[model samples]
Target: MKTKSLLLAALFAALTAIGGFIKIPIPYVPFTLQIAAVYLAGCLLGPKLGMLSQLVYVLVGLAGAPVFAEGGGPSYVLQPTFGYLIGFAAGAYVNGWLMQIFQFRKAATVFLANLSALFAVYLFGCSWLYIAMKWIVEKPLTIGQTLWFGFLLPVPGDLLLCAVCSILVARMLPRIHSVIRKQEVVS
Candidate 1:
């Protein structure tokens, strides 16, 4: 189980990194493929495994891998964007948790799950940004500004990714479950 978990985590991290390459830059930040990856990771992997996948991505990037947005290093991980990276873990974890706990196989259920995950991501990312700005930049940001830059700007793209990924994952669940089951059998 540990080996399989690690392997899947590595795979998701790699996928997240690759997805990060597809960027749509906004004023405050860029929209990336990570949302889709996060949604898919969570819906398919379940809460624990999905969160593990995101954690792996973060650890890999922090370890000096150039897999982060706009290239990566230790410095980038400390930047404001790092908050969003961390949020991805929350997004995936909550997304998977919702999917498993609720019947999210249908369209409406998927929508809510994705929305919940997005909300989780936004809350975490914005909170971290607010504190980081206060600590590092020495400028306190307003709720409006944070919402504009951190939450509002990213929502459209993230939602689009969520919709697409949710639909796709709904279909792919059987195959994913099969693989996980087979792994359990083999192990």
Candidate 2:
């Protein structure tokens, strides 16, 4: 069970890194479908294991794996994008927790929760970016600028990706999980 779960975590992390690699940098933040991966990890793996997946991602990157945006290692962690990286972890956990609270993994609930979790990602990323840009860059980043650069433009792209991920997961989760459960019972 543990091994299977760990394997899942690593697989998801690698997928996320792949998603991160394909991006177009906007003014406030880069646009990537990584958040879709984050949300999918949580919904599929649940909260505790979802977080472990992200931890594994961070550890892999710290170990000099190019599994993060702008590459990995201690330097990348210190980079401005680092906060957004952390936000990915937080967003995964938040998505799972919120789903558990709502107890609504139905199509409708899952859709809304996925959307909500997407916000959680951007919220953490933008807030962290604001602080980092101000302190690290020594400049005032206005709220208007932040919203425009961070939120408005990327919402559509993120929305589409999240929708695709959520729908795919929603369709596959039941069958896949059931197969695993059946194997466990047989064993």
Candidate 3:
């Protein structure tokens, strides 16, 4: 069970790196499936493993793996978008926690879990963006501007992704859980 969990976590981390490469560029931030991969990791692997997966992703990128959307290095931490990268782990953790709490059984619960995960990501991303812009970039932004640039602009797309993630989680969790259970029995 431990080995399986670690293997799956590594796989999800790799998938996240791959997801970053497929992006739609815009001014504020690039739209990528990376968050979706994070969502799937949590919903599929549960909180601990999912979070572990994201951590691996971050660690690798920070170590200069070039796995992130732009590029990767220790200095990447100074970038405004680094907040979203960190948020991915937090969001996955939240997603996994909600999935476990709701037992990943109901459509509404699945939707709520994904939505909450998205909120977690947004919260972290926005807060970090605000701080980084002020301290790192030396360009302070008002709360209204932060919301407009960091939160509001991306919301509709994020919400749509959350909805799609919810549906996918609903459809996949049962089978995935069943396999995990069977594997646990074998172990």
TM-score per candidate, chains pooled = 0.88, 0.89, 0.92
Candidate 2 colliding pairs: none
Residue-wise lDDT of candidate 1 within 1-187, one digit each (tens)?
6886788888888899998899888855688888787887888788889888998888888888888887777777546667888888998899899999885787667777878888888888888777777777667678788888888888888888777877787778777778879999999
Ranking by lDDT: 3, 1, 2
User: Where does candidate 1 stray beyond 4 Å?
Assistant: 175-187
Count of backbone collisions within predicted model 2: 0
Q: For model 3, how does the per-residue alpha-carbon lDDT over 1-187 read when each residue is reduced to its tens digit?
A: 5887889999999999998998877655677788888888888888989999999999999999999999999999998888888888998999999888868766677878888878888888889889999999999888888888888877777788778888878888778779879999999
**Order the candidates by TM-score, highest first — what do you get?**
3, 2, 1
lDDT of each: 0.82, 0.77, 0.86
**Residue 24 in model 1: lDDT:** 85
**Each candidate's clash count:** 0, 0, 0
lDDT of 2 by residue, 1-187 (tens): 5898889898888878888789888775778867877888888887777777887887888889988867777666555556667777887887778777776556666777677677777787777777777787777578877677767877889888777877777787788779989999999
lDDT of 2 at 54: 80
Could you tell me the lDDT of residue 109 within candidate 3?
Answer: 78
Better of 1 and 3 by lDDT: 3
Q: Following a full C-alpha superposition, what root-mean-square deviation does model 2 have from the true structure?
A: 1.9
